[model samples]
Target: MTRGTTNPNRLRRVDRWMAWALGDLLRRSESAPVVVDLGYGASPVTVLELAGRLRAVREDVRLVGVEIDPERVARGEAVADPPRVEFALGGFEVPVPDGARPSVVRAFNVLRQYAEEDTPGAWARVVGRLAAGGVLVDGTCDEIGRLATWVDVWAAGSGTSRAGVGPGRGGVGPANAPVPHSLTLSWRLAGLETPSVIAERLPKVLIHRNVPGEGVHALMNALDRAWAVQAPLASYGARQRFVATARSLRDEGWPVLHGPARWRLGEISVAWEAVAPR
Candidate 1:
């Protein structure tokens, strides 16, 4: 087990993003949608918070916090409400009751301790346990949640295209491998510097790839340039500056997703192709 380090609301940004971006998936589930908070750490607060937020999207949504450490699972069990919120003991081979597949798996800061080369295999194993149309949010963030980056991964299937770069030194994995659809970078925006500050917090696949000749490097450079160009808007607020930055990136042919509403929240999501590791 890696360090179970955590803090209250430390994951609020990603939780908010998921509830907004994946609300439809939860609502459309025929059965109560299942969401897994993989490696919830020592406190149950984050998973509990996730349950509260997601229940707004679908009241019947189920939450399962999985950890390899039984002590942590016991800690989660201490506060869990059975059938609604619960904890399980498992690793990348996600084990759910009755073989229930999860609609979404939020694995934040879990892979930080793992070898980069093991990422694709771990992703494949976890994505294989996902319900159809499900997604795996593999992310990394700072201790207080100031800066964050994540990849939206999907299992290979019909309609799935080779979207982003693969894990480790590989470009893209096999056609049948799990693929990333997009990359999301988020910030607190309170004391933000250049957008490239997030490079250090990028998900495992892109972290080491943030160097010369890489798409992620180019993306960070472009983001820093855009942030500088919009520096004047900081007087209005960092939100305004960030929105302008997003717009600038979009104007420059970057496949930035979402609009001002999300941008105003210090979030910018782009198609994986735009920032995929070269």
Candidate 2:
């Protein structure tokens, strides 16, 4: 288990991405969509914040805060409102009441503690419990949530797997692979220095892979170059500089996603294949 260290609003960058960038996913969910905060650490404040932010999109969204630590579960319980939000004892299993799967699982700062080889397994466990059109967002971030990144993973298919965990009735198909869609980077603009700072918090699968000859390394190097080339834009503020750099990434065929609207918020996302380890 982690140190259970957590602070209020230590996840704003990601939250904004989920609420706004991923709103389409939520909109597609049933009247009462469900979201899972897989490992919210010692506090439940972030969970509460998630409910508040998401309510703006899916008003009837349900939220669950899963924790392996019984004590942490108790902490979440103290603040939970049944039928809408609840706390439970679970690890990567991602157990939810009534055998229902989650539409979105945000397991930030959860897999870094395990061996790199274990990342795919952890992902499988979570993705196995996804609802239709669900997305498993596994990621890592700094203590105060300034710099953050995540991979949007979609489930692989139909059939039963993971100890009684089978796909929903008429689910996609039988499978056991995670199809990652994109890699997103976010930063708190105030103290921003260089975009490469996020290399320190890359997911387990890509963290060590960010070395010479790796696709991720090349991506970072490309980003740094674009950032440098856009130096004169700094006079307009870091936002403009970041937007120009992101534009360069897209122009160079780096497959960058999103646009200036998001870049202005100190965020940019790229297709996963563009940087997946070779």
TM-score of each: 0.92, 0.91
lDDT of 1 at 175: 40
Cα lDDT for residue 49, model 2? Answer: 88
Off by over 4 Å in 2: 157-176
lDDT assessment of candidate 2: 0.82
The C-alpha stretches of model 1 lying farther than 4 A from their native spots are: 158-176
Error of 2 at 81 (Å): 0.5
Model 2 pairs whose backbones collide:
157-173, 158-173, 158-174
| lDDT string, candidate 1, 1-278, tens digits | 86888899889989998888788777778999999999888888889999999998899999999999999999999999979998999988877766799989999999978888889888888888888767789998999888988998876652332222223224255543677878999998998888898988999888998889998999999999999999989999988898999999999999897689889999999888877766
Report the C-alpha displacement of residue 140, candidate 1, in angstroms: 0.8
* Residue 246 displacement (Å), model 2: 0.5
Model 1 RMSD in Å is 4.0
- Residue-wise C-alpha lDDT for candidate 2, range 110-206, written one tens digit per residue: 8888889998888877877788667788889999888899987777653222211223234433564566777888887765667898999998889
Relative to the true structure, how large is the alpha-carbon lDDT of every model? 0.85, 0.82
Clash tally, candidates in order: 0, 3
